[model samples]
Target: MAAVKLSGKSILALLLMYVVLIFVLQMWVGPRDRWAGYSVLTPLVAAALLPFRRTLLVGAFTLLAITGSYGFGVTGLSVGARFVVIMATALSFGISLIVCRVRLEREERVKRLMVARDRLSLLSAASSRVGGTLDVTSTARELAEVAALRFADSVTVDLFEPVLRGEDPQDLPADGCVTLRRAAHVTAVAATGRETTALRANSAGAGQNREVHVPARWLDPGRPAATRVLEGGEIGASGLPMPLPSAGTGAEGWVTAIAVPLTAGKATLGLAVFARGPGRAPFDADDLMLAEEIAMRAGVCVDNARRYTRERETSLTLQQSLLPDRPPEQQAADVATRYIPAGSQAGVGGDWFDVIPLSGARVALVVGDVVGHGVQASATMGRLRSAVRTLADIDLPPDELLTHLDDIVVKLSAESLGDHGTTPRGDIGATCLYAVYDPVSRDCTLASAGHPVPALRTPDGVCEFVDLPPGPPLGLGGLPFESVTLSLPEDSLIALYSDGLVESRHRDIDAGFKELKQVLAQHAGALEATCDNTLKVLVDDPPQDDVAVLLACTRALDASQVAVWEFARDPAVVSQAREAVSRQLSRWGLEGAVLTTELVVSELVTNAIRYGSGPVQLRLIRQKTLICEVSDGCNTAPHLRRARTYDEGGRGLFIIANVTERWGTRQSRRGKTIWTEQALAP
Candidate 1:
């Protein structure tokens, strides 16, 4: 059976009853009787139920009562019986004292065990709470909260500046001073029902509001106690002399504080302080040990969080640098673009877009997506963008350009596999859409490699996706890509985007496309405003995938700015072509370029007639630059070469190249068109 505890009042009542019973017994029998000494039971009950001091008082009272009974001559007896009673009474009193001592020892031992159990529970809770996040500030705040609730009236967490920034912890300050930044501070309500303000101090020369400089004397390594705590990773206690005088009114009851070094491995991250108020009990050795355990657990978590933050910042910086600051301005199109990275957990991704200016007043609108996230994906995106720009410089057709890109991706994948015996992640697969828009023809030729089709919005606000062929994604060799050309009306809007804009876990590709078209149709304004609205409507907050959107509005050259002519494969038509070019230049007010234009036209027409097929044609365009074009049913590309002294034919193109800003040939559906651009007169 469990022991029943008696209160002090109950013990006193029981002792009084025993005294009266002893008197009654002496009156009934005699004070010299053998049972008379049984009065000792009064003090023994007191020892079991009352405190030590109260038990001794009860014993003395019982002894005096016995003496009074005997002195009153309540029982007539010889000196021998009296001596026996007195001896028994003294022995009983000695036994009661022993019982009181044993009871006090057991109570003390039980109290210590309870305190230890409570501390262990608090530490367990702290561990579970502090390490849940990989954010340094969050971890520090959690530690402060746990300590303030369980360990002390107030708690403050301060970390070394470098440690907070994820850098290696430096040695203590050279001048024997330490700089620490306060990460979190929490104080309990005072007895007067008011909140206490925490102390704040800025580090000398640091200028940061949250940081403070601790003097060398306070943390002197030479002191045995300081060394034991700083070097040995133990917890130490100190008195704070009201660091905040103004706030001291509310914290008037605060007195002592315990400091625990937040050490992880061999490096000390910072310190955690737990303070007690006047009404609250001062921390004992056991409390200091508990604080140390909590700080140790928090230190490791804070370090991990800081490292993660640093890496995330680095990856984001690298990705942003790789993206274009702004799309290049071109006469072919007005461009606007938007790029948004995925959520933090998803890290940086490989989605990218660019507006590349090509020869012949054409612009290549590109959008691409690598398969994965992080630095590797971003690096791959950069490499692919560079490759695209290189290939675009050669003026390859859209389909052929993607073919070269596919080969590059395939080689990269193979090399990665060769190095590791397995394909490297984030380096292999990607999807891309390439589109070229020419303002002179108001035509856009586009091709895709496992990429989403682009949306086109006519000037009248009608939006629809272009039905271009989809080829296999890059790195998957052997698949051929096809290009489709569509003539856009002047001021028509063309949208190129990565799949992240149209596809997510909750939304399907078709629904995203529908929403995209709806948003574009509703907004009828400048391309920049349209781009902003598209992003606002289609992209969710912290998008699940990297998003890239490129919007361009086509501007076509007017018919008055263009002239075309057809000629037979006859030598005499060269003169007619020259006269036609001169008349066009005269009508267009390009009198300064007339002489150069006529010579260039005569040379190009004669070459076409002699070396090219019949039914040849010539076209002139007046735009940002003066363009001269000659076309025929010829598939062969023209090459420039130096002529020996005997070669009169080679100098024709050489002279044209020198007179024009740039010259190139583009393959058309029927044949090829060799063209040159000259700077227009100011």
Candidate 2:
């Protein structure tokens, strides 16, 4: 039960009543041991009704009264009664004092329990709300916000510079000097209404998570307690003029603050600062413990985020290095491309595109997506992109190139199974669209491996998707890929893209395609602008998956730039072809190439006639280079063997090889075409 508290008037009345009672006991009930002990009654009453101090003062008064009665003889008192009064008054005072102390101790214990419960609530809030994501800045902001709400007036979380970028933080050195980036700073000033508190949001330094490197001495800014804490010491509290958040206002200084290390096991990732301004209660031991627990939780979260950041950075670096920043310049098409990586939460994705130059003034347009996210998918994308380039170098047709690519993916999946027992996507699945556009023929032969079809924009500005058949994606074995050959008009645009460009969470794939078609048809500009507009109109910000788009405009070789001739399998045609090539080169204003062209034409034509069967065909094309192609109906392949001193036949190909910039044979269903290119003057 609570002790009774008397009013000031009531306390005085009690004192007067004690005096009156003493008078009665000494004057009327004189010399009686029972009446003499009545002095004890006043102090006991005061103890029950008054505070400890009041009870003691009243007890002192009672003893003085008892002494006066015995010494002055106002009422004759027995020595025993006098002893009784002294003993009773002394015992009353002692009992009142002990009860008061016990009450005070109990109240203090209750207060501690209340504080413990609040801290527990704060810790619970931190766990549930803070570090809700694997993003470094986001988790730090969460920690600061959660702590500022209930525990401290202002909160700041500063982490090592590398930790913000998702890398491991170095340990605090012996000198305790290191630079840190301010991740989050949140301050809430107290308001009159507890229900509606004014929260002031502020970002650290100039911007959020800006890693501004300064002298290490500035970390604590003359705050000795914070410096010690940063030097691997325990949590420390101090009063110092700490810097406020960049946007902080209405609050200039802090009265007290505590700095706790953000630690995961023995590793210190950063520090969290919690402070109170004037009129707010200073942090005590309980608040420090609470801050430490929250910091520990934040540290683990930050470490997890850091790990993810590091992995993502590695993957992105690899992806960037593997992907082409700009397509290599080629004669077949004008090229432009755009690539945007996926958001941080969803992890990195594998989307890649390329414009690879092929032989015979041909260009290969490619876009592919590995069927997953993260470093594995990105690595897989690199491998697939490289494979496509290698196969394209052999002048493989679209269907054949994808077939080879699919085989590679299957082999990769098998390798993954051998190494890790399973691939990330069950079998290293990926989708690709490979289109080879030959400017000489004005034909684009394209094949899709479970990838989106290209949207073709003709010269007249009509846009539509070529409803070509799509084969199974790479990694699916035993699937035949079909290629569709379409003749593109000069300056026709083919937009090849990964699925991410036309896929999103909020819309169906068909809707995305429709929107993309409209955007392409409605917008007209440079190839670069078209790429930008395509992404802007069709894709959401921070795209759900990696996005890659390649836009290429086709160009054709004019009839005047090309020459062709057919002849019976005879050596006489070699000279006739050489004369005709001279005439064509003159007409094309390329008389300068006549000597090399005739030599290449004579050797390639002669070789086709000697070893090959059926009629022979010779063609010359002028673009960036002079191309001489000789086709014959022969299944046998030729090798460039060194001629003996007296050899008559092998010198023909050896001479052609030495005179030409590059020469190769392209095998065909009919027979084979041996082609050679000579550099043209710029």
Candidate 3:
């Protein structure tokens, strides 16, 4: 009867014992008297051993001998007794076998379901552990605990290079009924190829299982196994799991360690280990499965952390590189500048302003904005800024400069289009304003390329935008640009800005302009202060796009206070030129600064007279400073050169460059005007 609940050998031995029991029962009992009862019990005995089919066969034969006693007893009696006893025994055996087999099959199926549920529970717990900590060490320890509870007799987590190890490196509490061991065991695993090990309670303590060494590479064969050893240790790869070699303190025990490789991709991030007692059963398929999942989750989190670190570094570098290191030099006027990048974590867009000096005492002031953001936008801004500075210095008019810029953009589009297998037309465009100012003549010339018109403020504080029809944006329609001329009053200011300042998502262009005018009216005390306050009022937050502004205010000289002198034309004109200018300044109440004024005027007027066959006019004005303007009928522009030491005539412009704060020439329909300006004594 016990055979049904026993192993194969136990059932066989039980059958032999049953045979002896039957022989005793038969010999001691009176055959005829108990024959019918023994016959009925024969089938019951067979049924008891049915679950162990091989032993059941032996037991059935043993029972048959005992049943024969019943038949023998019945043979000694009447024919009716024998027939009843044999038939009843046979029927009982058949029914018992069927019932026992059915029950055993049901038990096996239930066992399988229990095993599957245990595995699912382990996986769910591991997933929860992943969410609690961003640090890899704590995550790894939690994962180990999950593994031990679900799969092994005990879990020994040997982290080679624990990616999840947090900064503090604290100990992870063991899972229920699990023994925790945190050690760098990757090298031993790689060299030995094991994930877990068991130690005997007496040998290393005693009552331990054999150690099994499992190589991390066993999970995914594609990853190289050897490189996973930890540094400065004999361990292979960065981390690996190693099973204990044996159950004893000595090295002679059964294999007990299993190693699990922790990795996101190719590199071994760390390892997990499982160990079983030497006499206990080896780890099953479910244990191996649980370890694999833990490693995979850990790998993903480590990869994310590394990626985040790299991106942050790159963004910081890019933003710093895009900003200017120092303010631009003031060539013709006092200048102040400030640049604020897009305040987001990524980067700033392309917004830049530059002031470049042109020949003949004119300065080109430029402000521009490139579209887009991040690395690409920063690069494009650099290119456009350099181009504008170059083109401006080459004496190109504002319209021509914009046209050349447009050509550059078109060329860039043609070259870069479809470069990445996608045609990106009209994806790039820039808004820029170029203004050329002659301090000497107090004339400001401007050209806009799909850019905002500058607001002009008179010396008396009257502010208005230069009323001109807007031209097409660069890289749009290739239209000819019209250069606008404005008579600049001394000490007046001109403000140029990118559209970002005057165009908002919530308002139209007209409204933005109105707002800009209001800001100027409220903060129009000083050039630098006005620009700073106006920008602060307009932009309370970082602009959604790039913004650039350039402000210039004239330091008008007073013409009424300028000295005047009349002289007769003389053959030796150099002395007369100097005398006429000096005497005029002395008469006009500027005797203290007459030397500088006289010297510049003499050179300019003398050059006009010597180089031309027409009349020339010399005039001086003083506003915030003194200015000397000489007009001649010749339309040819003057050249400033490093004159040879013996060349007396060519030193005129060179001398002017050293003496005045600024100077320039204006070519009008009448002829050309050359002028120089000097700062007044405070």
Q: Which numbered prediction scores highest in TM-score against the true structure? A: 2
What lDDT is reached at residue 524 by model 3? 51
Compose the digit string of candidate 1's lDDT tens values, residues 494-534: 89999889987778889999999998887676778888888
Lowest summed lDDT across 10 adjacent residues in model 1 is found at 199-208
Each model's C-alpha lDDT? 0.78, 0.78, 0.60
Model 3 segments more than 4 A misplaced: 1-337, 343-346, 356-364, 394-397, 411-428, 436-444, 454-466, 486-495, 502-518, 524-543, 550-555, 560-574, 584-606, 617-631, 637-682
Which scores greater on TM-score, model 1 or model 3? 1
Tens-place lDDT per residue, model 2, 275-341, is: 7666567676656667778888888989988899999999899899999977898889999898899
Scored by Cα lDDT, where does model 2 land? 0.78
Residue by residue across 1-682, what tens digits does model 3's lDDT show?
A: 5554566567556656665675566567655447345445644554555454753565366447646765563345666765665566566656667766776777788987887787777777777765354333445445554554245544434433223222212222232211222431111121122333411121132212223333334433244433322222323221223335431213433235455655566655444555544445665555555556766775565445434334433543564565456445434444455555554422466677777766544578887777776566666777787788777755677777888988887676666577673876436777778888866566778888778888877767677999855777776756777788777876677787877777666777798889888777664557688878877866537455556777776643344555444333343665776777777667756788878877887777777777744567666665546667777778887888997778756777988999888887866556777878788777
Clashing pairs in 2: none
Cα TM-score per model: 0.77, 0.80, 0.49
**Which of 1 and 2 is the better model by TM-score?**
2
